[model samples]
Target: MAALTVLALAVVAFFAYQANAAPDRPGAGGKPDPTPVEEIVPDKPSETDGADDENPALPPDSGDGVRVVYSLSAQRLWLVAEAPDGLGEEVLHTYPAHRSTVDPEPGAYQVTRRDEAIPGSDGVPIQHVVVFHSDDEGIVFGFSAAVDGSLPDPSAQARTGGIRQSPEDSPQLWEFAEVGTPVIVVP
Candidate 1:
């Protein structure tokens, strides 16, 4: 009995030491030590970029908040985030992309999975895959970039749901679209 009691006390003491050794963080039963986050102000869009009705600031109806807005018609994608000040949202990056073979119907979806590198449906090496949706036919839809920086062949009869982005741009999208992050598809 004494041996068992000593063992129980040792276990409790070890946990107490671990708890004291843990780093202090905000909302972790410690005083909030808020860290200031410096916001990166991406170059503001040119006034004329949306001066024409052809391209009005962001898609006409992309919902506000931290989300990835994909426009099927414009063949563009925008990574948006809540401003550091919480005043509103900011478009961290935007770039042109090739449309996926199977479009997730115009609606809201969330990033479901991701792959750092894999062979795309077209048998080409792709990286930074950020998958968000899948169609009824079991085709998975996601954003990726060809390692060789090649865009999908417009004439290829391949049936793939991979939206190809520029090699320079795919990494940014992959970093921004984490699992459960909202993805808004706008027509």
Candidate 2:
């Protein structure tokens, strides 16, 4: 019992040390730090280049310069990466996508989870799943593609929260999006 108590205290002390010892941040005293506001640098641009401009949605709508955009009204998705110099955004991929019969609200969401293959709520085999939103009823709004490239045809009574993509698009989405990646939905 004494050993267990010591171990617990050690764990608490480690956490407390971490909380108090952030390397680059201003100390608790809030003194002026060495790194000035003007000297701060923006994030470096992504390395990938734009995909073929032949896509109909070549010029994707800017969700305020965010990387990924899902248009509920158009049923389309655009995958963008920042240009190497931060001068602009490059359209990495754009394709026709399908949304749930009940669309999610227009807003920004982050990729909360991913799965390589899983049976959807409607019992369809899906792949490249990246979930971003969910409703109170446990219905999730996510991107997936039917493994066989079949367009989603949920029964009329089936209220699915799946936003499906083409089989071709699924792999790309899986590779690009990870946990915390921004997924902006627009009406």
Candidate 3:
């Protein structure tokens, strides 16, 4: 009886080991799966030809002597002028600009005059004048005069003034200056 019990225990252990162990090779059922490995590498830079060299110049509506062109769509003001070679145009200046909220206006704005001195400095003021319009969309154009010194301190006292509009326009024009409308820069 003791021998029979020992033999039974050995048989159970062998089956348990076989069930838990992984097979070295695939059985007749299916092929074994391959082990997966991962690798990482940095990106490489690529060379490119100068495609921008062939780009066309700004439209004629910008003006023949247009030293600068400001596009509301691109939100960028670019200065276009004749290059030194006198063949193609060159970019003289590029600046980010805040567009006007008024709709349906067109044209390239210009700085015509300055109204008063700047807040703090005894420098020149800002004034704008409309020179050209790209479309009859009713968009106005103008420029603010350049400041000579640093900007005024905001915490100081505020100046009070009122703006008046002509009888031919609506109340909106009176409240705020529309886009393309020139502003007189004051020192």
Better of 1 and 2 by lDDT: 1
Please list the C-alpha lDDT of all candidates, in the order they appear.
0.80, 0.74, 0.35
Candidate 3 residue-wise lDDT, 79-139, digit = tens: 4445557886554433443333332234434433223323322122422222233235433
Ranking of models by TM-score? 1, 2, 3
Ten-residue region with minimum lDDT total, candidate 3:
34-43
After aligning candidate 1 to the native by TM-score, how far in Å is the CA of 62 from where it should be?
A: 1.1
The best candidate by lDDT is 1
RMSD of 1: 12.3
Candidate 2 lDDT over 103-135, as tens digits, reads: 888888989999989997667899889999898
- Evaluate residue 153 in candidate 2 and report its C-alpha lDDT on the 0 to 100 scale: 61
Expressed as tens digits, the lDDT of each residue in 1-187 for candidate 1 is: 9999999999999999777657763445554332222333443666866433333367868898999999988888888888769998777778788974566678999999999899998889999899999888888888999999877765668767888998877767776778999999999
Native-to-model Cα distance after best TM-score fit, residue 40 in candidate 3, in Å: 47
Which regions in candidate 1 have their CA more than 4 angstroms from the true location? Answer: 1-41, 47-56
